[model samples]
Target chain A: MMTIKEIRKRLDGGDISCRELTEAFLDAAKRDNPALNAYIRITEEEALRAADAADARRAKGEALSPLDGVPFILKDNINTKGITTTCASKMLANYVPIFDAFIWEKLRDSGAIMLGKGNMDEFAMGSTGETSYFGATSNPHNLDHVAGGSSSGPAAAVAGGLAVFGIGSDTGGSVRIPASFCGLVGLKPTYGAISRRGVIAYGSSLDQIGPIAVCAEDAALVFDAMCEKDPGDMTSVGSEPVTPKLTGSVAGKKIGMAREFFEVMSPPVREAIERAVKLFEKMGATIVPLEFPMLRYTLSTYYIIACAEAASNLGRFDGLRYGYRAESAADLDDFICRTRTEGFGKEVRRRILLGTYVLSAGYYDAYYNKAQLLRRAIKNEFSEMFKKCDLLLGPTVATTALQKGSGLTPVEMYQTDICTSSVNLAGLPAMSVPCGFDEKGLPIGLQLVGPHFGESEILSAALAFERETAGEFLKSSGMGVKL
Target chain B: MISLDELKKLANLAKLSLEGEDVDALAADITSILEFANTVSEAVVDLPKDEAAGAYNLREDVVAPSYPAEEILLNAAEKLDTYFVARKIGGTGA
Candidate 1:
C-alpha cells in the first residue's frame, strides 16, 4: 500500500531503479501467477523496455509525471494498441486493438510501466470471474476461493501484488466485488466521470473504467489520471476537476446506514457493517438511518436494462465486421450463426439471449422499457436519501469469497451482488475498503457510497477508515503484502 | 416461472448449443433472476410520462478512418482479398 509519493521518493533517491522495480514485479508475478492466475498476458519484455525508457528520461532531468516509472496492469477489456484486447472471450481471441483506449493513452504519457492484461468476465458480463474463457482468477487471500470479478484478474493482480495498481471496468459491482473479496481498494467513479471510449462496451449507460489498488489514495492518484472529457465518448462529462483531498477529518460528518439494504445480507456481512458503523462513530461521525424502499428492485432493473443494452452493443461483433469468424459456413446467416455460436461462451450467450428476448419487438414494453422506469425510480430514491446524509454505508457483498466452483446456482451467485448492484443502478460513486477478516481469515469489505460525482468524499472516507481500522494489509498470503 | 423448454428456446435463439448439464444449470439461475425481475416490475408500476429520456449530448458525428481493412481482416481464420470467404449456402455457389 505504498503511496505514489513514497514510491516517487524511493525512485528519486536512487533507492530503487525503474528497471529494478519493474523486474521485481515481473519476478513476483512469475511466482504468484501460478497460484493467483491474475494476468491474462504478462508483457515482461515490453514492460522492462518501458521501464528502461522511464529511467533514461529521469536521468536526462525530464520526469514524465508523478506516476512516471510506476508499474501497473490493465483489465483486458480496456483496449491496448497492438495487444490482444479480447474481453476474455474467444470471439475476439486474436483481435488486436489498433488504437489505445483513452485512459491507456493518458497513462502512457505518464510513463507508467504496462505490466500487461488482467482477465475479466467475457464482455464484462458476470459478477464472479468464473465466467471467463481463460479461467477464474483465484483470490490472492485464498487460492481455493474466487477473485470476485468480471474485474477478477485486475483485482487479483493488485491485491496479490502482481502490480502496484490495476485498472478495471465496473458495470454493476465488477470492481467492488473483487476488491472486497481480495482485500484491496476498488472505486467505481460516477457514470460519466471517466471516458468509456476504446473500452469494450458492456452496458453503455452503466459501464465505466475504474481503479483497484492496495490503498484508496493510490486509487485516487490513478483516478485523477483517468478523469477527463474525451470527445470520443459521447457520455464523457467535463466538469469540476476531481481534486481528491484526504486532509479533512470525518468527525461531524453524517454517514447513513440504509435499513433496506441491510435487510437482505448475511450475518457475517451484517457484523462487518456494524463494525464499520462503530468505527465511524468512534471517528466522531454521526450514524443516521435512511430508508429507500425502491432499492429492492435494483438488481432486476439492472439486469433488464444491462442485457438490453449489451444485446445491442455486442451485436457489432458480427462476423462481417471485426472478431472471430467461423471457418466454415454456408451463407451470411450461417456464417454469423456459426461464428457467434463458436465464439461466445455460455454465460455471455445467456446474457445476449436474455437481452435479445427483453428487447425483441413484442417484449420490449414489458421488460426493457419497464426496467428504464425502475431505473429512474431507483435514481430518485437515492437523490432523496443523499439529501439527509453525505454517504451511504454497507457491506460490499453479502458473503465472503465463495470457494471456486462451489456449486452455487447462478441465481445464488447473482445474489452476492445484492448490496453492490444498487449503487451501480443509481449511477453513484462507491468504494470498497477492506474492513477486517471473517472467522475463517477471509477478508470482509465495507462499502462507502457517495452522491453523484462524490468521489472525493468516497476516497476520503475510505482513506480515513483504512487508517483507523487497519493499516493497509495486502491479502497476499505471505512474502509480499504486510500490514 | 421459466421452464426448461423456455431455457432451451432462449439458448437456441441466442445461437448457443446447450447440453443437459447447461440446461440444468441455467434453469436454476434464470429462475432466481426472475424473482428479482418481479421486484423491478413493481417499482416502476407506472412508466414515466413522455419526457425525452435524458439523452447524452453527443459530440458531432464524424466518420474518421479506423483500422485498415487489411489489418482488421488479418486475424480472420478464413478470408479472401478484401472480403471474408464463407461456406456456400443453398448450393447456389456450387
Candidate 2:
C-alpha cells in the first residue's frame, strides 16, 4: 500500500532494495491481474533485470530521477520495443514493436521498470472498457461494473495496486473517465504537452498520452518525466516545462461550474459536485455559475470528428500489409473480409462504419464538416467563458459507473462521455480528481478544466483540493475488491 | 437516401467487410447517426468559413533520416528484399 513517493524514499534510503520493490510489484500484479483483467501482458523477466541494474546504480551512490526503480504499466497502444503493442485489437495482437515510442525511451532512461501493458479499447474507440478485444476491465471498486475506458486496464491496474501508475492515451476522456470511475487521478495535459510518437493514433488531432495514477501529485511527477521536446513527434512542444513555473494560488481562484453540466448529472453526482464546490470554497476558491449551451451537442460532434479520424488512421491495418491475415483465402477480397471479420470486435467495426459514412464523398460536408463547425462553436463558447474564470468544474461523468450489462443502447453509452469530451474538443488541459462515491459505492470524479496550456493551474487547484479533503480513494473500505 | 450497398461501399473504403445483414444494420445506424448530424446545422451558427475551410499544411520538403528499406519492409506480412508484396486489390491496370 505504499505510495509511489514513499517507495522512492525507501529505495533511496537503502531501507529496501529496488530489486525487492520490483519483485513485490510483480508479485502483486500476478495476484491482482487475474481478478482485475488490468494487464494484457506482464514483463516480469525484464522488470527483474532492470530492477537489479537500478539497485547497482544506487549502491554506487549515483543520482537518478525520482521515478528510478519505480514499476509502472503502459497502455498497450504505446509501443515498447520487443513488446507487442496490440492496441487491444486482434489484428495487431502479435505485432511486437521493433522500436520504442519516444516516451518509452524517456521513461526507460529515467530508470523506470516496465511492469506490463495494460488493456485498452481496440484502437481507443470505446468509452467503456467493454470494447476491448481482450475482454472488459472490471472496476477494482465494483466487479460488476466496468472500468471506464479505453484506458480501463490502465486505471484498473493503478487502482488495484498492480502497478505504481499507468500511461493512458486520452482522446475524449479515454483517460479521465476511467480514472474517475476507478478513483484515481487522471491528467489529460494540454494538447502537444506530451509527444505522441510511437503511440498508436486513434484521432491524430485529439489523441494525447497522459498519466493515470493514485494522486494528482504523482501525476505531476510522471508528467514532468515525460514532458520533453521529442524530435520524433513534431507536435511535441519543444523543451518546455510548465508545472515548475506554476506559482498561482487556488485560494483566490475563480472557478466556474457549468449549470448545463449540473442539469445532466445524477442526483448523487450533483450532490458530490456541490460538496466538492463547497470544499473548494472553504479552501478559499470561489465558484461561479456559467452557461455553455453548445455542450449539448458535444457527443455528436466528437463522434463525427473522432470516428472520421479513426477511420482514416486505422486504414493501414489491411491484413496483407501488417496485421493478422487469414490463413487461406479465395481471393484478396475474401482475405480482407475474413481477416477483418475475425480481427475486429463489434464496437471497432461499428465505429469504422460510422466513421466511413461520415467521411464518405457527398456526406462529408453534412457530417464531418458540420461536426467541425460545431466543434468551433464549442471551443468558442469555452474560450469566452474562460475569460471570466480560471477554471471550469463539473462531474467527470453524468452518473456513477453503470452496472455491467445494464443494456445501455448506443446513444445512452455515448452520453456517458458527454461531461468529458468538451475539454478534448476545446484542446484544453483537464484532470479528474476523486469527489465522492455514489450509494452503490462507486467513485465520482470532479473534473477541473482550464484554458489551453493551463495544466499547471489545473493541477495546483486539484492538488490543493485533494490535500484539503484528505480523502484517498484507496483508503476507503472495499475499494480494492472486484468491481 | 443511403442504402445498404452504399454502407458496404463505405465499409470497403474503410477496409472493413460486412455481411449483408451487418450492412443493413450499419446503414440503419448511419441513417440515424446522420439524422442526428442534420441537427448540427441548427445547433451552430456563424460558423467560421476560414476555420472550417482549411486543412493542416505540411512543411517544405526536407531530407530526414528514414527507416532503411529492409526495416520498413520488415513489418509487411509478405516482403521481398527491396519491396513489400501484397495482393493487388486495385492499382491502375491491376
The reply for model 1, stretches above 4 Å from the true place, is: A239-244, A470-476, A479-483, B1-32, B44-47, B50-53, B63-66, B86-94
Give the clashing residue pairs of candidate 1, or none: A329-B87
DockQ, structure candidate 1? 0.43
Model 1, residue A91: distance off in Å is: 1.5
Alpha-carbon TM-score of each model against the true structure: 0.93, 0.94
All DockQ scores: 0.43, 0.41
Q: Give a tens-digit lDDT track for model 2, residues A1-483.
A: 345787788888888888888888888778778878889999999899999989999989774787889889899999887777899999898887778898898888889888899998888877778888888898888888988988999898888777888899999999999999988899998877888989998887788889998877788878888988776676777335655755435888899988899889899889999998998898888888899999878888988888888888877776765778766556677667768867887777777777888888888887788888888888999998999899999989988777777776666677888998988888889999998988888999999998988888888888788778875454432333221
State the lDDT at A394 in candidate 1.
85
Query: lDDT of candidate 2?
Result: 0.82
Model 2, residue A433: C-alpha shift (Å) = 0.2
Docking class of 2: acceptable
Q: Tell me the spans in candidate 2 whose CA falls farther than 4 Å from its real position.
A: A242-249, A472-483, B20-24, B52-60, B88-94
**Model 2 misses residue A8 by how many Å?**
1.0
Evaluated at residue A152, the lDDT of candidate 2 is 90
